[model samples]
Target: MGNTMLYVITSLSVGGAQKALLNLASSDFSRDYPPVVIALVEVDGVQKQFAEAGIPVHVLGINRLTQLPWVLPRLFGLVRKIKPQVIHGWMHHGNLFATLTWWLAGCRPVLLWGMHHTPEKATLERKQHALVLKVGRWLSRFPQQIVYVSRRSMQRHAELGYAMQHAQVIANGIPLGNNREQAAHYASVRQELGIPANARLIGSLTRYVPEKDIPNLLNAIRLYQEGGEDAHFLLAGEGMNAHNPALQPLLSALPDAIKVHLLGVRTDAQRLIAALDIATLSSQREAFPLFLAEAMAAGVPCVATDVGDIAEFVADTGTIVPVADAAALANALSGLLNQAPKVRESLGEQARQRVAARYSLNAVIQAYQQMLGKVATYSVSNA
Candidate 1:
């Protein structure tokens, strides 16, 4: 059997889809598959992680739509040379590009499409994505399967005429480890961020995008602080730094009592999450947020909006509030902070157990192996 798989992705940026592909490529499952990565754009944050895992990465240096034609030949050339038995595409652009490239290369390798985001109506980016999905629907028959990270996303896409022959919902999983290891770093992380040792820490790890509703989170923090809660808010991710002009208004609106630590794009996200007393997600839309799972894996209880699989992820372990409701978010956060230390600790333990039992990396890899094995058999039988 040919033990080769090629994964095509938009970029190696530090986002959910990129992280998911990185996890899949670096897992023990790769021992059988011997994965290769190809990014449509120049590799950035996660390229080193892949390289260290002995995976070769190819970048096509595509930054805009005009470069598609110039890069197609390059993609076709690589596909022919590698002749992988399975070509997996991550996200919409990667899926479309992989299908077209495979067709152009005249190959019959099993093609798999991975979808990571939920459909939302308002954003212009989503509108563009809808157009892409329309085209992908026409090409759906070319891929052996379309994998969605959330059941809601799959159903919503199906309703939008994405009638693929084979579709599966595989929730994103986190690699679990000893929570104590991270817990030990809590005091130091707090000290480095200049957060008082006695202050309650509520942290959020997400990019500063409209969908993330960061201002709504800020408003909630304001409400919480107005009520005289002794808490510090930590916001970390892309575009979350002090120099980001967009954050100025929101930061100014926050009460003086609330100390806001804006750590932009920290590579030490896991340590920051470990130091958090409660993790949060204020996104108005999500498919299956990897951060929520990561927080749960770290045994930190989460408080998230009831958006995309969040309620399911938190289920009895953490609090879930309605979307864009600052007051409701504030109330939830305050209630959790007011809980006795032992009660919060118990909830965190429950969160950890839930992630270990349901969303462990081992389980996710096994499911992918089964699916790939079946797809491989089918491809061979057809040939």
Candidate 2:
């Protein structure tokens, strides 16, 4: 009920969940529940984004997960010093560290775990997720709660044998910026990129990873081109490398006429969305992507694979196709091109309205505020 300090996340890069954390940091809700963010890892470039909103941030400077043991004592010391009302975690590593640190700190700030996805399997860069899950189960004794960005993620966790009752769905929101400015920015960006004035651009804004199914979208584009459409496709995001075995061969194999452009990550996603005639998300697995919400906020008609809670958010507003189905995705994309301008505009309006009503920046922050209050109270009562 009083001002709440939130030790939010610890990540090396500023990704979707980090952006969501930024939105929360920038909210006027501080008038009701003041929030503080502490990144357990070095708080990458996101610190500036929060600082622009006059929010002070703390970084634990955890350089590597292997150094977690070295960081734990300091992390605990920092948490005790800060004594936030709620110790919240954003993604898996952050969640594990925050939950463990809070518990070790005698659960000073109520432990609130933020689950961004169905826990990802271990990769060469990170430890196994099963080990993380074991830690979560062992630490479930604390008054811990979860905030799932979508119901799909919540269901996935339950299917994996985690407690469903402790989790709540809090869909991430898009920042309500100046739509006109976004449009102008898009115009300049398109001009700079050398896109033809009349060209129809289909954009897929996602990290170039295996789960994202970037190849599926490329295949769909191939299908669209083979059927005689001259659409320009842009794939934008950071961390894309054609050298990685998972993605390298596919990039090499793309047809010359397909005209694929990889515009590595940009913070000005709204501008990119504004430039797009249509936005696409070809992920084979998603909980609820901020990209889809962002595209809709820019009033771009979306064609997304029905992977996460996308169907629920996009109901009747845009096109949805089965995951990895090139033909179905191609049909959906083509179906929009022949539609009247007024009709397409109406669809775009619907997409924007959906975001405004349900996924607005204010709405999501309010939900977190309320959830934080409840978790803090619950933690205190049980303690």
Candidate 3:
């Protein structure tokens, strides 16, 4: 098996899939076969991290589908130069793009695709996305292998007419350790926000997107507050800051006694996750909620609405509630708070241990490396 692999994805933005790619590419197991990131469009910041990992990154510099024709030449040239033994796509558009590259480059590398989304998105997906999803089903058999981060994603895609013969599930992983030092930083963060020492600091690390259901989280918080509890809520993600006009009214509606601190697009998620008394997620859709896994890794007790593979992973470590039910989410959060400090601390340690045992970064990278090795073998034999 040749130790060269190329990864294609729609964008290199700071999201779960992007972070998973970064973690896999930068890990020690991937040192020999570093990533050749082919982003469909130019996005900020992550390119630098890839470069620092000694991975080559290529951005097509195109925004709309109309611009794809202009970038085909450049894409073909990259494939020719790299001559990767296996070409893997990250998502729907990326899978299609890699398929196009396989045809245009005339370099028959073994092709693979990665699917990170679930069917929950299809309910409200735009026309363009619907078209891509349709195209993916029609062309799903081309990829030698298709990898999903969760069992639910794999099963749903199969029901949607995707080929399942060559598919497998490889869950996302995070760097694991007891983040005592990073967790301690939460105290200073709380102090800066003027939160009383005795107050529970509940934190959520998520992007403010429709699928994430920020409104659902706000409603849950409001319900909890009305139940005679005062807590500090810290939400860190893109469009979560005070500057977002859409989010301001929701923030204003929360009782002044219940503070919600919005820190937009922070790079220090580990520090924030470690310092929290509880971490929560209220997403309407998800595959494998990376934030909860990260929170568990950081030794924070979690209270998340059951979605994706969240219930499977969280298990007995944290509380799970019904999706979109603010009352249930609020009750779960309050239940965690009602526990003794030592009890919560014990649960946090158990959460950290669960993450370490199942979803370590090393295990995931090794799984990818092994899978690609098999693909390289197939490529060589088929050639």
Candidate 4:
């Protein structure tokens, strides 16, 4: 554990930040750093993935803000015991907690912060995040470096008074090889979803949150269906099912001919992507969504809103539309769906190439390794 790097995140949930951390932890880069993960709250989801990868994960059992006082001492004790060379924080609450723990433990490790979101639109889920940004402006000197998953997120945080001098941008990366096995399951996945073999499958992998704008996607699907397109939709993520009262009305309003399968929190997302003719994202806010990258890696063309870095990621490989514009989304989907098989395949190839060249997991892992090496040297010199 000489070069141990402790990763502190708000939780070990199956979101973008947690997924990125898992990628980093499971990669060859972790061999040099020997990464350990610490969740501020109790480890719920995706923690097993890290453990299975031979990474040690610890939970502080701090479920809410009220538990901070009791949990801080536990964090301090862990810091003193582990004596990690670096303390890397993910997201707002985790960053603040890491900074506090570093100060309290009197540790000499280099501190780094990671930001995975864009604060373009304020929502109740992000109210605490807004407060953290305000407080981070004053405590910006704590972290040796702050890594933003997208350039847009870096710019937004800089504008919001975060430390610009120490900021860096590192986009999320996906393992291209991870989808290779999924090709074998494509037909089976479609059959499992009750979709016809020839039906145009438009899929979205996202949590059913207000920011995701899943209703807008449903509206677009309705419009496309009204035009007599034979399509099926596969939406797989948390809160995507009809069990939610708010989404039941929207789900009920969809046209009868369009087959919609709501598979909540699926483990076979890559296989679902493999079975799709097109992937879609209707998010109002994001900072380089992982699903879009994953879809492209799976050689699936995407139709997404012009939010965050989605347009930049898709480039000419796919289509982009304005947020909340169901008509534009429908038109884009219709155009892609109407394309010849050869044409669509060509576009999908371009998407896969783009991801391979820019967002490969190996490249991202090397980037983090380089950063960690520098931070380690800096900390040793200062010590």
Q: How far is 157's C-alpha from truth in model 2 (Å)? A: 1.3
Off by over 4 Å in 4: 123-126, 178-180, 377-383
Ranking by TM-score: 1, 4, 3, 2
Tell me the tens digit of each residue's lDDT in model 3 across 1-383. Answer: 25577889999887878888888878886667756888998867477778877888889977887997888889889888888866888988899998987776576777889898887654427787778888999889899999999998998888888888889999988888555576467777767778776778999989888888899999999999999987889998889899999999988898787778888887767777766899999988889888899888888889998888899999998999988999999999999999999999899889988988888897787787788778768777977
Q: After the best TM-score superposition of candidate 2, give how far the Cα of residue 246 lies from its true spot, in angstroms.
A: 5.0
Candidate 2, 1-383: lDDT as tens digits: 34565655765354777777777666776666566676776733556777777776777777776877777777667667666666677777778777776766663766778888755442222556677666765664453678889887777667666765677888886876477787686678679788887778889878877778878877898888888888888777765544446666777776788877677656767777788888888888788888888888878789889887899998898999998899999989999876887888899889888999999988887787777677767767977
Q: Quote the lDDT for 290 in model 1.
A: 88
**lDDT ranking of the models:** 1, 3, 4, 2
**lDDT for each candidate structure:** 0.85, 0.75, 0.85, 0.84
lDDT of 4 by residue, 39-106 (tens): 98774478777888999989987887798788777887888888887788888878887787677657
- TM-scores of the models, in the order given: 0.96, 0.90, 0.94, 0.95
Model 3, position 371, has a per-residue lDDT of 86
Q: How close to the true structure is residue 357 of candidate 3, measured as C-alpha lDDT?
A: 85
**Distance from true location, Cα of 256 in model 1, Å:** 2.1
In candidate 4, residue 283 scores what lDDT? Answer: 91
Model 2 residue runs over 4 Å out of place are: 41-45, 61-65, 104-107, 120-127, 241-248, 376-383
Stretch of 10 with least lDDT, candidate 3: 119-128
